[model samples]
Each structure stands twice: as C-alpha cells, then as structure tokens.
Target chain A: QGGVAIAECAACHGEDGIGKDVEIPNLAGQHEVYLYRQLQHFKSGKRSHKEMRFESRQLSDADMQALAHYYSQLPR
Target chain B: QGGVAIAECAACHGEDGIGKDVEIPNLAGQHEVYLYRQLQHFKSGKRSHKEMRFESRQLSDADMQALAHYYSQLPR
Candidate 1:
C-alpha cells in the first residue's frame, strides 16, 4: 500500500532502510508504534520541522502505518 | 575526539551508527564528505527539515564535522 511512498523515501533513505548517515538517522528495525507516532507528528505539525513537515504532509494515515510496518520488520 | 558528541547521538542512534528504525535512516559507512555537507545544510537551513533543523541548530561546525567523521567510519 505504501510501497510508493517507501520508494520516494528510499531515494534519500536507501532501499535497505538505512538513511544517508548519522545526521539523517536510521529508520530500520524501529518500533512500529514509534514510527507511526513520528509520521503523525510530521503530518499534524506536532513535530513542526520544515523538511519533515513537507514530507509528512503528503502522507495519509494508512500510508504512515504501512511505512511503520515496513520499517519495524527490518533487522536492527 | 567526537566521543562526547557521539554519546548524545547514541541516545537515539545505536553506538554502532544504526538508527532507531528504517524511518530514521542509518548513518553507518556513509561518505564522510556527504555527511559533512548535510550537516552544513542542516545548520544553514538549506535542508530545512524540522526535527533535523532543531537538532542541527544546536551543533557547532566542529561538532558536525566530528559527527560526520564518526558515522562515516561505521559499518553500513
């Protein structure tokens, strides 16, 4: 469902779930609940950052959950 | 040299450079130069991401460089 969004995210984040670097932070193997919460934060302005807000603004609740699912399953 | 700064980072990113999850992105084994540039972007607002902006805003140029160096050396 969110494979498309994952693809876009992969452009910068990488196909394997690794981010660009330490500055970017890794998303693989994270808790699904945490991931969902962060995406929600980005979407609702609770997190309130410029880049994330733009990225988060584009996602639907379902999309965010899918992303959370995909990442949570990865190996830490 | 960057161990202290790295300590703060380890709170979220693992001591090994793996991030919290797939959404956060890993920093291990990334290009040093690329890492440096992104830190600069975060500090200068060129990247303009929210959570990153706040995080970057608190770092000194030296701190950023140190962080870049530490992550680039980790295994990807």
Candidate 2:
C-alpha cells in the first residue's frame, strides 16, 4: 500500500532511505514511532513542508505505517 | 576529540549511534550539517532536553564536529 504511494519519495530520499543531506534527513533506522509522528505532522500541516504535507495528506493511515516500516528497516 | 567525551552517549546510543527507541533518536546516516545545528540548539537551550542541553553545553565546537563525524560514519 505504502510502497506504491511512497515510490515518488525515493528520488530524493534514496531507494534505501538514506536521505541526501541537511536539507532532507536520513530516515533509515529511525524509530517507527517517530516516523509515524512526523507523518502525522506532515498530514496535519504541523510539519509544514510544502511538498511533504501535500504528499502525506494523500496517504491513508495504513499507508503511513507501511512507509514508516520500509524506511525504518532500510540501512543507514 | 569527541570520543573521550561522547563515551557516555554510547551506552544507550550504541557504539554506532543507533539509538534505542522512540525515546532516543538514531544518528547514523544523518546529515553532519544537521547534527551540528542540533548540537547548537542544545547548547542554546532551544531543543530543551535536560541531558542533551547539559552535554552539548560542555562541548567545544571542534568536539562537536568530531562527535558528528563519528556518528555520521556509523551504519544505520
């Protein structure tokens, strides 16, 4: 579910979840709890990234978890 | 430079900066630039964690980089 939607995030975040730099942030190995919180933040506009907010707004709660799990398991 | 001081962080953060859980954050693969900014935030009391603020306040700029580098190279 998340894989299909999250495919677009990989271009900048990397297929393995190692993000580019300070501008982004490495998501690999991060706590699933934290990732979920951030996703919620994004969706609710608390995080306020123009792109990420828009993207997260489109995701269902289950999709957020799948994306969180995928990134959490990726190698940092 | 940072090794002698940061030894305290390893107990929970892991020798590799793979933090334990939602309570602690992983540092591996994180941006060096972001790490520096966070350290600065801790020092200035902006981040507001009792432990991190005290810890970062005691560090010199050079020590911050050394710690940042050490964590940056560790695997996620």
- Write down the lDDT that model 1 would get: 0.75
The DockQ figures for the candidates are 0.10, 0.37
Worst window of 10 by summed lDDT in candidate 1 chain A: A21-30
- Using alpha carbons, what is the TM-score of model 1? 0.56
TM-score of chain B of each: 0.84, 0.88
True contacts kept of each: 0.00, 0.45
In candidate 2, list every pair of residues with a backbone clash.
Answer: none
Candidate 1 stretches greater than 4 Å from native = A18-26, A30-34, A46-55, B18-59
Which CAPRI category fits model 1? incorrect
In the range B1-76, model 1's lDDT, one tens digit per residue, is 5667788777667788777764555566666776788777767876556777787777888889899888878876
Error of 1 at A34 (Å): 4.5
Q: Please give each candidate's TM-score.
A: 0.56, 0.71
